[model samples]
Target: MDKIIESFIEDFKTEFNYEKIDKSKLFEHYVNYVLISKIYPDRSSLDKINVGGTRNPGIDGLAIMTNNHLVTSQEEVDYFIQDADLLDVEFNFIQSKTSESFDMGDIMTFIASVKEFYKDGELLFEDDLLNLRDLKNYIYKNSIKMEKSPSLKLYYATTGKWLGDINLTTIINSGIQDLKSLDLFSDVKFIPVDGDKLKSLYREIKNKITKEIIFEKHTILPKMDKVTESYLGILPVTELVKVTSDDDGELIKTIFYDNVRDFQGFNKVNTGIKTTIERKNANDKFVLLNNGITIVAKTLNKVGSAFKISEFQIVNGCQTSHVLHHMKTSLEPSIFVPLKLIVTTDDDTINDIIRATNSQTEVKNEAFEILKPFHKKLEEFYLTFEKDVNKRLYYERRSRQYFGAKAKSEKIIGLSTQIASYIAMFLNEPQSTQRYFGELLNSYSNRLFLDNHSLFPYYTSGLAINVIEELFRENKLNYTSKKFKYHLLLMFRIQVAGAKVPINISGNKDNEKYCTKIMEALWDRENALKIFKSLELKLESVLAETKVLNRQAYLTRAFTEELLPTISNAKKEGKLIYYNFQKGFGFIKVNNSEDETFVHYTELSKVKINEIVPGLELLFDIFQSPKGAQAKNIEKKDIVKKSI
Candidate 1:
């Protein structure tokens, strides 16, 4: 197969002048169309040439016909020869090309040119040329008779690449159908010639013609050129001047170096300018005398202005109070102003103030100042600002950069939950608010929830809020300023109770009752009551403390100590743990063991507990055992340090 393909490619290269043809591939399309059109007899007229010219208006090319009269151009030969005896024949217009790729625009342009030629006063005939006006008159006189003749057609002939996949037969048939729809042409035909076929036809035609018909050598067409131009204009300058001060010795030296480097290759610098000094005090009072001498002995005067006699002094110093003022008045509007000032002052304090102000204009100066203080408060403020800016920019960029189909769905649920929660909180109705939050949490979990680090916090927080809100609502607990404290205490106790512990409770046993006992002890209840009663007391306590305790502050403190620390420690120890307070249970890996242990906070006794730490040995009675190993007897053991 490879050898055959290679041979085919070699033959293709030698068969045609590939570079000369604008569309070498078009030859394949014409051949495919001609072959396919032969399959349908009803479309046989599609194989005919189209007639169109000024003197001999319909002179496209030969057409496919059963009779010899149909083979000739009607307008040029048969019409005049037959005279009143009109011969009826089917024909099509012929478009000849030797290009590989054909553009739609080129086809449109050809159609437009044809339309313009026909509209001109000329007609193209076979034997004698006819003007467009004569052709129209002939068509008008024989309109009904011409309709009786076979319909006109459009024929395209090319010697380029084929338009099929491989066999060169299945070209898109839409182009053929479009040709038939034309009012002037009744059918369409596409004829393709390969290099061998084209050579054979040329030889055959040359032999058939009695006169030597000159054939021009095919040459590649010129392509369109694209060019772009830009312009820069020189502005007219009235004058050029440089302003400086005697005190700016350092700046002057640096400027001089820069100017020398910039103009090193230049011939010379333009220096035809005048210089002047206008001194003024801070109060805008002129200091120069009529004779340029001090009225009184030169001395420090708070209310008096003084000018020192010096070359290269600041120009228009009275009109310009500062460096910014001087730049605005001196420089052109298009030029950028240099943000530097030179002030000559004898007072050390005044010089210090100017130096400090100058340094502040630099980008690194603010960062240096922030580090200099080294105060915790200031450091925290800087960090906070940095983090806020980063987060704000990240979200802003994210919102602008991406939009997915799921975004609408996510936003709807998120916004609804947020609005509902705010309303519930503001109304101080914990139960209603909790139900709303639960709906929100479930919605989030069901739809957008993914086990990603950034999303997990929101998932957990939503779940926690939902659980607490539901408990408060079910128990009719009213959260007040004083009760807020006990509420947080209860929340913390619940969290600690839920910490990792051995799960020995049987699945068949009443888990609620066991959890109720643990809750009663943790909340310091009167006694171990029913599970429902314990839950009620817990909610009541939280409600009472809400009046005095800051809810957010309490939650944060408790979370940091009781929950976050243990999680952090577990991570540091390379242990994996999963917690779900809404379910009142959590799981932690047993040290050096493949087994995982489940703990129920509802069963733990907070009052009896002391100095609880992870990995510390403890004993608990196994109320029920379903699977795996567990501790049955509940008791505390001495802390043991593990060896590395």
Candidate 2:
């Protein structure tokens, strides 16, 4: 296995220029081969024959079926079919190409070439046409057949480098429907090869070809995916000696030895320690000795003696109290205690002394000893640290919300544009809106406009202005005002101005004069202004009366209502009241039991408000009682007031 893997790697480097391949990727290739083999077991034992290349214009390879018949070219495909005695099964053509990558264009080209080879015009013998075209046509015409049958299959085997280059979904979705519609076979399959799979198969083949494969192992660690390596080295240590004065007026010398035998040859070593001791009396002298040799001598004015030693000999010098103190201060705390007993022969003896002395230490000195006992609690705190950090993040978000900071200016601008587009869409119907603008609005809002884009108020206003100007220019209407305000106002209500109309009393001077005067009056400044003011007042009044109505209509139809129904019924026994058609217009009923009081149309004038269309909503104040009911006042509601 190792030899095969190594050979695969070498071959991969040469073929694909990939020096380092992941083991999992290589293994996937072998797995794919095993799966394919299991699915098509019969193909494994077919005899391998070199099919002539396209340059030679002949078969590229020949594969014998279970029977001993030879099938050479596509034209001889039927030979095996008829020779059941010698050929009991069918074989598929395997076209092999060595490529750094495979692509859709390559597949298409291969298919096209195969189609050209078996084309109707390429027949050599009359029977050859029947031999090649029969299988080819059958496969192409019924590519999606639901039943299995004897058929010829085409296989293009190449290095799978191109598999990753294209979207597999696109390739599958693009031609899958067409392929399935062909109904050629019970099923059709496309296989993509990758570099890893190819390497594994190549290794397997190379191992079979060469009985002995060479495997090599490197001592240097291969580059890990996401890791680093570090190194540490041990240094040699030398022995030392020290001298000190004991509390009982006795001179003591201690020898310190190096634990590593490699440093035993060193007799003397430098000491990184300095200390001073005062004598009790004058004229006192002391000499420090190690191994019967006087290493240093010093005199003090006091009775006590003092000595200083800068260097010590490994074999002859003794370790004094000052020397021990210097060693402790010189080395790092982690390694100081371990190195102090280097001169001791038995590690167990030193450990026992350390344990006995540690027990005598006070609680304050043993603070570090609790670390082992509280390790689990420390681990729990570490695990929950992330959760605490998340809570702090949540608190920050809450604070931001509470502060109510304005959105970024850029975002505000973007939102304003989006809202403007939305309002435009709402005013106009969706169908008339530009496709791109509609797309932008819909994408931003994640919704479609309900009203037609053409019916937008702004668009309608522009159209109305255009119609009025056209009428004025044609002399159909007169615009005497400085700015044609009345004409503009009339245009808002002249829904039929743009509609087609037939001329009445054609060529009659009297009729023409009357029509001209009427047009002039309609376009008159005062009249136009009157109409404008009327419509404006009406809009305001309707909105004021129907605060929820306009919003409801906007939510429903996004337009003003043109007309609404009103129904009236007699509520009391009354005689017929005379109708008033001049000043006010409405039904009037007189109460018979009473003194025949008249119920005037003026009493219901509040409900007589107009311009009640799909988009307009009106508010009615009703004076209701058992005797009868009547609307006292009509008004438009304000949405902003209600919102506040």
Best by TM-score: 2
* CA lDDT, every model vs. true structure: 0.29, 0.30
Per-candidate TM-score against the hidden true structure:
0.19, 0.21
Residue ranges of candidate 1 with Cα displaced over 4 Å = 1-84, 90-92, 101-104, 111-137, 146-150, 165-179, 182-186, 193-196, 203-644
As for model 2, its CA RMSD to the true structure in angstroms is: 40.1
Query: What ranges in model 2 sit over 4 Å off?
Result: 1-49, 55-93, 116-119, 123-147, 151-154, 160-169, 172-181, 202-644
**Residue by residue across 456-493, what tens digits does model 1's lDDT show?**
12222222233333333334333232223223323332
TM-score of 2: 0.21
- Model 1, poorest ten-residue lDDT window? 289-298
